[model samples]
Target: MSQETVNYLVNLLIGVILAGVLSQYWRLEASGQSLRLWIIAAWTLAAADLFFVARSMLPPDTLPRLIPTITVTCGHALLLLAAQQTAQRPQQRRVICLIVASHLLLLLLLRAVPAMQGWRAPTNSVVWGSLSLAAALVLWRAADHVRPLMRFPAMVMAFQAFFHATRSLLATQAAVDANPVRSAAVQMLGDVEVSLFMVALFVGVLVAYLRQSNDDLRRALANVQQLSSMLPLCAWCNKVRDDDGYWRRIEEYLSEHKVSVTHSMCESCATKHFDEFKP
Candidate 1:
């Protein structure tokens, strides 16, 4: 098969794998809101890649080109949302909406103005690059404890930003149509890069999620340790049962567990012990 066909197959495979894995995790409730966005983004990305695979078969029309571009851009936006949520950052929904609207407007303008058609590829590249940069910045500025875990994904985003910016420079209308060899090489390189980015992103997000789970587990253990009221105690003997089912005096149990014990008498106990005890 031709190199282009091979690249298309590879992209299709990557997209399907990512979408399937993310969906499975989503069903499992592996995370929360952030993960839900991630799953959606993964599916969006898969759709974009599918379009890329089918573009060669489809007629050379604006709709075919426009569809994948919009799909991928939307996918990037979803990824950005996921990153913002993961970082516990304020999601500027209005700002994101405005940005997406502006991008769509630009695309619409290109479609309406024949003279501006040549600028479509560059415009899309700029938007994708900007979104990648935004995701990188969000990951970099996440909470200190999770920042280290996020750095790998941030770096991946940064690399993708550079790739998109470079692509924008190379994919001008004249350049694309004039030189078939150079364009093919660029396309091949891009497919490889995108696949790498997708896989790296999956790994990075999975690691971050695992870290979050570990943090949650640690917090839960701390809370469990602090909760002593749930312990089984015998009212008559005033003894507490240990985990091993051995009963011991309350003071002895608390002392054995390294808990400080204090002596206090409730009003009822005091009143029963001393007739002069007041409320």
Candidate 2:
């Protein structure tokens, strides 16, 4: 198959995989909403990839080039949002608005001015790199709260940012014109880098989810153990004082805590209460 055909098929497959993963996560009620944001990010990235695949199939200028650029920009923005959500950080509306507006302005410039077309690659690189770096920074700041495995995701984002920044520096028209072979090599390298980054991102998200689930399970077990421990009980009444300072009968307390108890009388209690019938 031709290179274009291969690229289209690969991107299509990636999109399908992302959609499947999103659907799987959607059905999981226990994953929580924040966790699902990662799946959303994946879907957005897949959409961007599909746009690229479509571009390969159609003739140049058949579709607005700006469409793919906007889609990719939105995908990167979603990645940053997902990272922020994962870190449990508050999303700053002002910052998000500014980023979106800047992207829109860039898109307008690209569409209106012929001269600005040459700068498109570098401009997109910078924007995408900045988003990736922001995600890395957010994840890094949340390192203390999350599991050690979270560092992998942060590192992956940082690597991606660095790669894009490097590309921006090397993607000049003069540089490409000077050495076509070198330019082609660099482009191929970027494709590989992006593929690797996607795999790392997916794996990191899965690891994060598993770690979160494990932590939740641990907390639940600790709560159960605490309830099973010694309680402050009245010596005569056999009533327990709970965390709220309310005294309740043992049966009532256990029932409230969702513990099942079988009612039974001890031998001494039975004999003392029924002396006439005692053996």
Candidate 3:
């Protein structure tokens, strides 16, 4: 029932999911490289959660608390990167770096001024919310063939974006009023929401990957069928050309390709080859 216990469970679940995702990445072919970014993002979030659970034990200073904030911000950024890769969009690396740099600068400024400590939560929320929204939009607006595969993950991202935005507003109010109970309540809600979102988003992404892989397999099979139908045959010899550019009897080619054939002569061929039939 305690928030701390809840956070511990959530973190443990994230760790398990992260491990499973990494194993999946390993089992997949090279095409699953996009999952690398997601793994990193999940790791970043796990680090943040670890810091969050241990925040009470940390020294009473802005620097110590900023660790979680920084990690969480980076985690969102990496998620956006993963989304872009999934959608097969050109990654705006420079823009992403600039945004991160600006956020770090803002954090430094906040740290310099003790009076502005309250704004940290809102600032972090804004960055996270914006990044989540961007990722959702990217997936939603992807190419038609890719849109269906990404739709669920996009929806999850959109929901998280809205959650973070609303949380940001609550954080602003809490900062302004210095309300401990409201702040604690917001934190609890955020922990639960984030845990749910992570589980859903990753599951959605894994499903999307499966769909994409299946589509690719179907297309490959279709191509193979088309190619098989169009095999090159000699005009005079009736021999078929195999993949190695060697021509062989049609029967041989068919047999090599695992096709079963039965020997049968047409009436015309039978009559032409027999003198009695010709009469």
Candidate 4:
């Protein structure tokens, strides 16, 4: 309820968002499709949270929970899509999209439920709990099929989601209709929840994306640098005839493939070409 606490949490969230962005740099050359999308979702959530925090600064009227409800819920869906992409199951991508769309409708209808407006106290904890559990299950499934490095990020996010679901259930059930202290605690938990969850997922996925990019880059560079070895020939004449019938200078052949060469006569070549000459 204190201004200092609110400012501190919001600032922390901002820091998390920046850390996530920095992590993306590492994926510069990777197949960053999924990673990029997830970071965008996180930054979007952070932006919305910032906006909510700003609105809360105005007055003590009923805190507008709608923006955050949409932001966080949609952000979670985006996170799931990203996780699925990283796991390389594009075939199941449409299923994930359908799930997201269904949730959007559910969340939209939540506005009619007066008690749901303030998540600090859940009038019906079971509904939210079940939904959160299902999302976690989906994330777990995605993790099951992902690569090792990506698996960690997915697991980290799943853990974050689990905690968030627990926090929601606890905060809601403890004070849905009763104590002020419990309500305040619920409010405090809600205040910090989005920030915490977004940071974990964002940081993990960004690091994974950047790493993927780096791997892709290294592979590409290796491909570019690869050359078929030429047959060993007399280094004296500078001719590099391969197993093939064609005879050509090694430097000339390499040049055709965008590889530059510097001319240098080796000791053997020097000795053979100028047998009687002094250095």
TM values, all candidates: 0.73, 0.75, 0.76, 0.60
Residues 11-130 of candidate 2 have per-residue lDDT tens digits of: 657656855765585577445546666777777777766777666666654435566677777877887887887787887657866886798787677757765555666677789899
Give lDDT: candidate 4, residue 146: 48
Spell out the clash pairs found in candidate 3.
none
lDDT of 1 by residue, 125-168 (tens): 78989999999999999998768878888999999999889888
Top candidate by TM-score:
3
lDDT of 3 by residue, 220-245 (tens): 68656855578797899888888889
**lDDT top scorer:** 3
**Model 3 residue 249 distance off true place after TM-score fit, in angstroms:** 20
Measured with C-alpha atoms, the lDDT of residue 95 in candidate 1 is 84
What C-alpha RMSD separates each model from the true structure? 7.6, 7.8, 10.3, 10.2
After superposition of all CA atoms, the RMSD between model 4 and the true structure is: 10.2
Clashing pairs in 4: 26-210, 27-210, 29-213, 30-213
lDDT of 3: 0.81
The best-first sequence of candidates by lDDT reads: 3, 1, 2, 4
Query: CA lDDT, every prediction?
Result: 0.80, 0.74, 0.81, 0.57
> Residue 166 of candidate 4: its Cα lDDT?
73
lDDT of 4 by residue, 50-164 (tens): 6566565665433364555455555555656555555554535566567656655665565566555455235223333443444445555654424655655556655665665
Least accurate 10 contiguous residues by lDDT in model 1: 173-182
